[model samples]
Target: MMYKSTLSVKKEIALHLLFWVIWVYFTLAVVDANGIHFAEMDLFSSTWCITYVVTFYVNYLFVLPKVFHPFKWIKAIAGLVVIFLFFAALRYFLEQFLTVQLFNVQNYNPGTGILYYIYDNTFYAARPIILSSAFWLIVLLVRLLDYNKYIIEEQKNTEIKFLKAQINPHFVFNTLNNIYSMVHFQSPNALPAIEKLSSIMRFTTYEAPRNFIRLGEELNYIHAYLELEELRHYDKSFVSWETTVQSDNHEIPPYLLSPLVENALKHGSYTAEIPIIIRLSCNDQQLDFEVINRIGNQKKDKLGGIGIDNLKNRLEILYPEKHTLQTTEQEGLFSAHLVIYFQ
Candidate 1:
């Protein structure tokens, strides 16, 4: 924290110094005179530029921040007026008293009235303060954008964590129930189910925390899960899994594709004619996945659950406009089709 704050302060100081150096250089560039007269005028201009610098920094560093608050337009205007008066006073003292006393020279005639002198100086003195306000506004806008970006990223990470937390327990509870059923019956599949559960638990506990994993790794998890489901149903022929991947180098968010499969398994009617069909295809630029199953009348009402809802949230956050998910029921068939475009 201290290091970041110190770095920020250093950057601000550097920016201020650069601004002043550029301002002074440009002020000297437009002098339009030659030799001895130019030397006198150059000194005069440099002295006046110092006063302008003071005026600019005073307003920028102290006055503008205080006055540009909520319902403070009156204060802001008043602050500008005070800065203008302060600038006129500084110029008046320099041109009238100090220059006269030191070098017996003054830029203005001794007979010029104070009010007229001040009125004349307003146009010249206003430049620095106006630029200071502009500079301050630009800096404020940049900081606001940075802070907004920080806040959005933080919220996205928090939401992803929350969804993952919700998904893990929901998954573990369902799998544990499946294992309990096999154990209660004292079936030979109990040990295999326990092993499958161990593989799944390792994936969820260790690998799920990553933002993304290789496509093949996630596919392996899905394969293990499907095997576990087959053990649960005591029928290895109830699911048909197909994949056509040109390469396995692609990456995807962990556990993104499993909820659709889970929903289909929980609600699908298993028959020889219409077994649960899951198809996955991946290319260099896109991933296409579909889950099609015969809908059971008894489980149709429970079609959408926490898993699907959680998947929706994760998809919105992780993929945004780069993906599409469609779920529909047609002719006693429920299907979910998901496609994600890679860039």
Candidate 2:
């Protein structure tokens, strides 16, 4: 794509001019002012000659790629210098045959002798050698750009994999903590909590590893976990969740909503009076997932905890240029808003 884009009308005109300039300059350096070719026309008028364009077209279109590719550094700068030097030598031999035989113009007859052959050929060498050397430099720069793109792509993949791995260990740790709380309290509801834990565990272990899932299925799993949290802290605390969307079962990335809801519960103390709100809404091209909790002044330090930091990293890696995450901490409210562009 870069090759095609760079080679355009302007560049073609420049190459045409450059070719004639090179031809005239090199030829004039060796030939006298009263030479037969010089007598035919001066530089300005000679540029208009029909043979000039044809010579340039054949040289640039055919000879350019042949010499250029041979001179290119497929390896490194040292390789480029070495290859360009070799291709320059090869170019001299090619010029000897091509200028005499390829063009075959009627008026441009030359004496057939070996030393003059080598001299004329060697004289013609500079233009192609310089152009091919320039081409080699371009190839080296392109190679470096391609290498950078490869590294960035690999790094992106690694980060996505890390975000996918993040959720399950968090789920395990939360469930184990719940079980510990149950064992300590000697609560009769522990068995039922264990059952809810099993359902969530089964889904997270199986379904959440996938790239995407049905919104309905994810909502059902979230509902199950929320019910378990309710059962666990019912006598001592309060929590609530609400969800609305344009579609019933649209597909989205798995575990997209889990981290936000989990962070709300993870940070807020069990003794807060008001219910925590985890409201989620989605339209055709946008999703707004917000978590609102009331924290006393002393407990406000929980705002930038491990879970929220992980949440930010996951969003950055996943969306990069699309999603927006903002956290606001005012007098009594700690809230986070996540706006995702689903389109």
Best by TM-score: 1
lDDT of 1 by residue, 1-343 (tens): 1112222667878888898777656655445555322233554686687788888889898888888765377898899889998888888788777888888888789799978898898998889889999998878777777777777887898899999888888888989999999999998999999999999999998889998988887887887888888897888888887989999779898888899888987888876567999999999889999999998978682447888899998999999999999988899898999999997
Where is model 1 more than 4 Å wrong at Cα?
Answer: 1-18, 30-43, 69-71, 104-114, 301-303
Q: Candidate 1 has which clashing residue pairs, if any? A: none
* lDDT tens digits, residue span 1-343, model 2: 1223344568656765785677667654446567634435543333233333433344445544554566655444554344444443444333434444655432224555656544554444445545544543564466557677767767876776676676677777887788779878998778888988898888888887776788777777877777778778764246666878788477776777777667767776444457777788888888888888776445553546445666677777777778998888777777878898876
| Models, CA RMSD each | 3.3, 9.7
Candidate number of the best lDDT: 1
CA lDDT for candidate 1: 0.84
Worst 10 residues of 2 by lDDT: 43-52
In order of appearance, the predictions have TM-scores of 0.87, 0.62
